[model samples]
Target: MRKLRVAMIIPDNRDERRQYDRPEPEFGPAPAALLQGLQELPEIELHVLATTRRPMAAPAQLGERVHYHLLPAGRFAGLSGLYLPAVRALRQRIQALQPDVVHGQGTERYCALGAVFSRRPNLVTVHGNMRAIARLHRALPFTYLWVGARLESLAVRRAGGVVCLTRHTLREVQGLARRTWLLPNAVDPEFFRVKREPSQKPWLVCPANIVALKNHLRLIEALAPVAEKYGLTLVFAGGGDARDPYYQQFKARVAQHPWCRHEGFWHRRQLLEGLARATLVVLPSLEDNCPMALLEAMAAGVPVAAARVGGIPDVIEAEVTGVLFDPRDPADIRRHLQEMLERPDWREQMAAAARQRAAQYHTPQAVAAGHVAIYRELLQIPS
Candidate 1:
């Protein structure tokens, strides 16, 4: 059997290149894991093209089967000029590689939007609904959302298939793509694990980028009142650089609160450590699609208190596996937190249930197999 050439394009390589220096491992094992999983097909040749502004500390010779291409890009804030360059370079790279499929991850500024221009069987893995959130950029205005929705719709329409990280996002992209794949995100079982016993403290955590869509401000607002009533310590981790204006706004608000400890950012090990110490995780985002943060937190035996938006409800059940709260209403978050905190054993049961759910749904092996199956189906390769 001939090997299938695969080109995996990632746009958010700035953090992967360690440019921020803030230390959340910016881009973690996601790209690597994707390549690793695809390579497991044996008849697949995986080549990763990570395009970003910051240079990567990559090896001169990564491996025979694996190769990395770094395209120079301007700072993320000033990406307008680099878009044409990236699209041209990426198209040229795809031509040279002649991959059987062009797989793009997320709504990566360059990868998903730019790479979809290739007429090949492009597979876009959109983790969340950016169009819905683009409406909330504040700085970008409604015109931006209108333009973004058009482009994103076009991107979805052009792609041969789309792999939505959750069903919630799939529903949003309805009538756009010719084919949609319900491809959920995976977690490193080695890192995020099930707890043998419950921990002390009603510590709730939400680890996500300080983007507007994340609704960190709402989470902070909820915590202020929750802390007073529930005696909970809300720890905010995994921050963004100055580009994320929400971070500054959130910081200003958090400064007023004495109990909230914004840890800025932490990597995988440190994140797991925080999860280990916490009683529950809260991701009251306005949007989501199986956010890896929520999955990782759940896998670590920490229950989540997240919004019922996007694909989150796909992962968390209301009061069963984890709690759900309205993202916009801080008082609602506080109320949910109060109720969850009140039931100590209920929280424990939910965490245990979450761990079990992770075992069934978000494992690396299962995720890899699912992708392989989907690819085989897309190519119509006989079993």
Candidate 2:
């Protein structure tokens, strides 16, 4: 049997993805790893297409079946130009390669345009907020969301299938199309093994970028009273342009408050160490789509205190696997944090459940198999 050509579409730069993309390679490897795993199947040929300003060197082949193509993303058309000449170039490449299926990663214009221009039986994956994320930027939030929605709809119309982080996320693009599938983000239990020992001063950890809608400021502010009264300490793990106005205010607040410390960004291994020692993990974001950090925390046997938004409600039960709070209300987050501290047995049990769930669902082999099944169904092949 011949292998079918499956291509994954990504933004101009792997390191410069937008809000849904997070401009960071480490946070979302949906492209880097997912495609690799699919290629491992002997009867499949996988390709990755990403936008780039200048030409980039191709990676050495992972397996005989996998290939990568880094096309140059050209200059914007004119004033306030976002469409690039490379988009057309990509269309040409897609025509020539003629992939059996194309998968999109982020909401970046290049990826959407490339896939639209490709005009193939494609898969568009929503990492988070395809339409709603624009609300975060006040200045041009309307334009951002409007254009993104229009583009996303066009891409979905062109694709044969859609993959989302959770079922609730479909509410954001309900009428956009049919054939949407649910697939949550998962963690490797081996890498993030749980270590539940008798806990001490309940330490709180959050591994997310300090940005607006991530709602970290309110989380910090909530910590003030908690620190003064309950005696709490927080460790933040991630970095961005801290000098940005929102982040600057957050930084100044952090400086004034002695209880919280921003420890920059840690690699996956180092982050595992932090989570293992943590009493609980807090994911207080205004919006999200099953992020990797939450899964890692759960796999590491650290209970979660997250906001009730996005695909979060899909994964976390109010007091089952973990606790849920109002994303907008840091006071709510503080309450959950304090509750976890007071009831060690309850929180630790939640952590154990989280670990068990992660190990069962989110392994590389298991996730790979699930994805390959999607591809096979597209190709009308048996597993």
Instruction: Give the per-residue lDDT digits (tens) of candidate 2, residues 215-318.
Output: 88888877777686766678888786846787788788889888888898787666867876787788888878787777777777788888888888777877
TM-score for all models, in order of appearance: 0.87, 0.87
lDDT of 1 by residue, 140-191 (tens): 5446555555556767877778898777778878888889988677777654
Error of 1 at 305 (Å): 0.9
lDDT of 1: 0.71
The residue-level lDDT of candidate 2 at 220 comes to 85
Per-residue lDDT value at 308 in model 1: 80
Give candidate 2's whole-model lDDT: 0.70
**Candidate 1 local Cα displacement, residue 205, angstroms:** 1.2
